[model samples]
Target: MTSNPPIPMRPIRTAQSRFPWHHFSMRFSSTPRGARLARRLAGERLDAWGVPYGSDTHDTVTLIVAELSANAVSHGLVPGRDFRLRLSAEGTTLRVEVTDTRGEKVPALVEPSDNLDGGGEGGRGLLLVAALADRWGWYPCADGPGKTVWAVCSASVLAAPSP
Candidate 1:
């Protein structure tokens, strides 16, 4: 009996595999203006990636960028340090990440019953992020002294019929 060589098992590619294009990143000052610019540029980048303005994905991502960027400015700001905004699209998922130099002020998820509105000054941004994003979390910056907050929103999924 002849022994046959084992067949190679190739990795399967799903709908998420055939990526056409998806990546964006930029640095901004740790200020309110920088936060606003982050949101604007993120929208433009999504438009360039075929997500278009006024689309659900575009709006959701833009909001996420705004909230995270604002958090970086308000809670994570360190004088003279700049924050970074990174956008990535994989499959039907769009990820928004904002990094700042203040890792000590890590974000916390507030309960619906929490006094987000009663506090007055602020504290509702992450709540908005939680409501809109499919998933979100944060981690310490890999190469520096800070943290990167990230959120993911589902995109292009509802725009088309699934097989």
Candidate 2:
């Protein structure tokens, strides 16, 4: 059998094969459980895309997306509104994007404050996201409220085994 066989997918806004988008998305209640579900579902979807459960690609992507989703629930929460998680694997790039309805809470990569202790109640989530992601950033919604915190983990991450 050929290694790294092509993954099939439908066109999204005229998305092409080279731009092949293997995607899954869900809207979840703005709660802790919803954040957890986002993470689990991401792992499952990646598995369906040939990223093995314990593979580095799976674990890294799952963890980063989970942390970001959790932040969405904790900080960007809006009453009655849910958060969304979208995963897309194209060629050698995997993109994870999480959007919440709260427009005011602009996600940022905070600098570790002097008061920031190795042991603290908050502040580690995005730090971990930064460390794990090959490239990460956030952008304001072009046509509406809220922002999307997205991260891209390089395909080479899969070249290694999960620790």
Measured over all alpha carbons after superposition, the RMSD of each candidate to the real structure, in angstroms, is: 12.0, 7.6
lDDT tens string, model 2, 1-163?
6795554533322212223557778898899999999898888788767677886777899999889999999999889989899999886678999998777887777765666557456777899988988889998888788989999887555444223
lDDT of 1: 0.79
Q: List the residue pairs that clash in candidate 2.
A: none
lDDT of 2 at 159: 42
| lDDT, model 1, position 163 | 44
Relative to the true structure, candidate 2 reaches a TM of 0.79
Cα lDDT, all candidates: 0.79, 0.79
Model 1 lDDT tens row, 105-156: 8799865455547655576789999888888999998797999999977643
Minimal lDDT window, size 10, model 2: 10-19
Q: Which pairs, if any, clash in model 1?
A: none
